[model samples]
Target chain A: MVMSCRDRVLAAINQETLDRPPVAVFTTCDTIGMMKASGASWPEAHSDPQKMATLGCAQADYFGLESVRAGFCLTEEAEALGCPIDMGTSHSSPMLKGHRNKYDPMKKIYDEPNDLPDIDVFLNTKRVKTTIEAMKIMKKTHGEKYCVVGGNTGPFTLCGHLLNTENLVYSVWTDPKEAQKWVAAIAPYCKAFGQALLDAGADIVQMSEPSASTDILAPSDFPIQSGQFVKHALGDLTGHTILHICGDSAPIIPFMFDTGVTGISVEEKVPPEKAVKIANKRGALVGNVGCAMPLYKGTPQEVAKAARASRDAGFNVISAGCGVPIGTPDDNIRALVKAITG
Target chain B: MNDKKLLKELADSVVACDPNRARIASEEALKEGIDPVEAINKGLVIGMGVIGNDYAEHKIYLPQVLVAAHSMYEGLNVLLPAIPKGDLSDAKTAITAVVQGDVHDIGKNIVKTMLTAGGYIVNDLGKDVTPSSIANTAKETSVNVVCLSTLMTPTMDSMQEAVKLINDNGYHKNCIITIGGPPTSEKFAKEIGADHRDDDAQSCVKYVNSKMKKEVK
Candidate 1:
């Protein structure tokens, strides 16, 4: 019997043999062509659950992407947390406006350990509600056939946005106990948010924690700061959980597995030989494809070649290294999908 | 304290990321009539060198590096005023900013701080900076390099636009454009007409050092 898209993705995440390897993208599926075709433009699409759902569904319904991912921008969680946001253009993700914590304190955003924004406020925000609605719509329309992937700001990245990135880093050094407390406070929210995504009908929840990557943070700090928070935040997911971090994560791959996620999504910078070997011992390996050069700028043939190479090397599921860029050619995305399905 | 011991203390304070210690060391050096150039070179810069290497090697991470930079800044605010105005003539002047449509600045901040530690006179334009402003700043400051950073792929075009504005404004003749960030690459840099693209702040500093022959005061 032919496996459904949902089965294919679940099988891949569970490391089961597939009719063929499943192709998935853990990043945003929004593209200019996708937006134009689905009649879902950003700024509006970012706010309107209907438009956002259309853009996400177009991934599976339109481009043959196995997983339809939503929450196009990373700023949604920050917006809910009280950061002023600029919903970017049709081609861009929304970004946090001026530094929110620059007003009252110099050393930190929250003067006291308990001063962090209430988790209830974040859950009730319009953006979060819209995202939940979008996930529901995707699950309703395509969940039976395709995997509906939902995510929000992971703790480290969200903290980076809340307190200025520099201030957060400084506080982590100057007052580690306080920093840990702040992160601990955010952990429950992270769990609640991920649970909300799953409750909204997502089969897999991706904790996109790029800030915790080895590229940006010290490898030593990963297990302590980001690793601990991620473990606390998404450890109890009823559905499969995928942890996606940007940049060369070879050094921290083992630590990522220790977080107890079902799968790990790494970018092209990590050597496939290493990722495959390490992932075999830990969990399912999702990606090692270049998102920019081959997947976005290179021809379909190049993308297919890249995908085939990743699959041949033991990557259970083929995926883009990072979020698919806005202007990435439709054929490039199709090349990835076709490489697996065909 | 002897000049050597005092300078070592200054360097140690920064490596420890101790602002109060750094400030106190700077004051002691000033009271001892130690030359400001020696204090910055033998003390502040030396400490940053260690921090930079630790960061590059992953022996230390963002928090340590950021706090160390802050400590250096605390020391420099005391020592810099004492340096003779003309002593920095050979130092290259550079401007750094996160490109328009992108609010990410941690990479840009690291580059700016590292460049300063490398003895460059860096003017940070902060985040969400416009291409016109980048070009205008280059023209106004007569800088040797303009460093742009963007983590968002959508803002990659803004890097190209900034390069175009710099070239159109004729600042390209004097100012070399460099782009850094996750999505930026050598191909993207060349495609955008940028002169160079470095993987990190340290590499950018080395690139600028080789090109400008920055005097290590």
Candidate 2:
């Protein structure tokens, strides 16, 4: 008999072949049914160790997936660092509230990597520490059974929230060096945060860095802009690592391989075959589902077909090409399972 | 101010986004005595048609394209005032909004700016607007076109519902209702019954303009 689902996933993470490909579901704690079942609630569930561990365990049973990751939005690190997010509603993800200049007026963002508006708040903030604890507990509970993926906001994405993007994009044109200074300030947060999870028994660390993605930035600036720092920091971490960027990154797909990530998650807007071919040349790939289509609106059978298509396209794991929407139907996951096991 | 120079200049004005220069050029062409319709069509509208293509190609960014449309608007704004009133052969109205529940207004704003640049009097409803507001406004304002945008997947259903509400209530019978955004698709448009769908803000102006047809005499 197999040792455990956890062992299976860990072996898979190290690129060791297994009975089947490892599956990971990127989810947020806000899911209605999951929260109700696990009795975990936000801010607390986000930072509470037991609640996070329980919730993390529920991921496999809930979605029949191979990996369960902690933390949904990269905004938390930025929010911890003193940004006010317009959390919008119970349903939506938080967004930086004001124009970039309104809060972070100071240029060259190196003000001692405080995870919150003040240095003290970050130190006390329970979520980061809670999440790490949850990872350890998850390992204790399922470490023998499943793969646990821990996540951190990349340096540039964290800084994008901190410094604000309004001036960042324009400044990219006017002054490259100044932008670099702002980006460099947040590197410590990602490194520390990533290290926290690794220390807690996370088998793989995922960097959810949207700002580094080409959707918002020119491909030419990706490497030195932020990728280099992540490559080094995550490289030093004990577990295998993956980098996920949202949106079409056709122009930068080939170059992204140089970042040293064991895997990359690109969105469906990118042709899966192209991404697969690129990944085949560079490394492993996880997704390219038309997230908006099957995951959000398509029927279970249609979603299963989409899963088959993803497999045909040559992905190692079939998942939402982007973050799984909270509104996603339960049947969608079932369809993915049906497609995979079939 | 012959037919050739006037239209060419109007087209040039839409590209340059220089309203002041465009107005002066249109006036000079008029003084030199050119066919107003020819100048508006061959020069201004036609030039914007090309800019729409470039905008889609990413050959030109927002600032350049918006300013170019502004130049056309300036020239048209001047012409509208000078046109022999009541015989307004080139006036058009359009209503644009960044659908309710979505906060991303930058794209909607750009589309409004482009429409204005292309000589269409646009009703900018700002952002987070409900379908009822759009439909009621369409009825009251007698807009020739209605454009709705939503940037979120959660709100995409609302966008689809907005179009359905408009059509069910007969709002679409009066004016063409359309939608666009990152999540929108031709299939979505067909399922929900949007009269038109545009992937580019600049192209939307052209689509609306093309729908106008031989301005009511």
TM-score of each: 0.95, 0.77
Which residue segments of model 1 deviate by more than 4 Å? Answer: A99-110, A113-120, B86-90, B214-217
- Model 2 chain B poorest 10 in a row by lDDT: B60-69
DockQ comparisons of all candidates to the true complex: 0.67, 0.18
Q: State the lDDT of candidate 2 residue by residue for A206-295, as single tens digits.
A: 887666665446677778777777776565566678777776777777666677877777788888788877666466677767667877
Per-prediction RMSD in angstroms? Answer: 2.4, 5.6
Backbone clashes in model 1, listed as residue pairs: none
For model 1, how does the per-residue alpha-carbon lDDT over A151-171 read when each residue is reduced to its tens digit?
776787787787666676667
Candidate 2 residue-pair clash tally: 20
Which number leads on lDDT? 1
Q: Show where candidate 2 strays beyond 4 Å.
A: A27-56, A99-137, A162-167, A211-214, A224-226, A229-238, B1-52, B58-96, B99-101, B123-142, B164-170, B214-217
**Model 1 chain A lDDT-worst window of ten:** A100-109
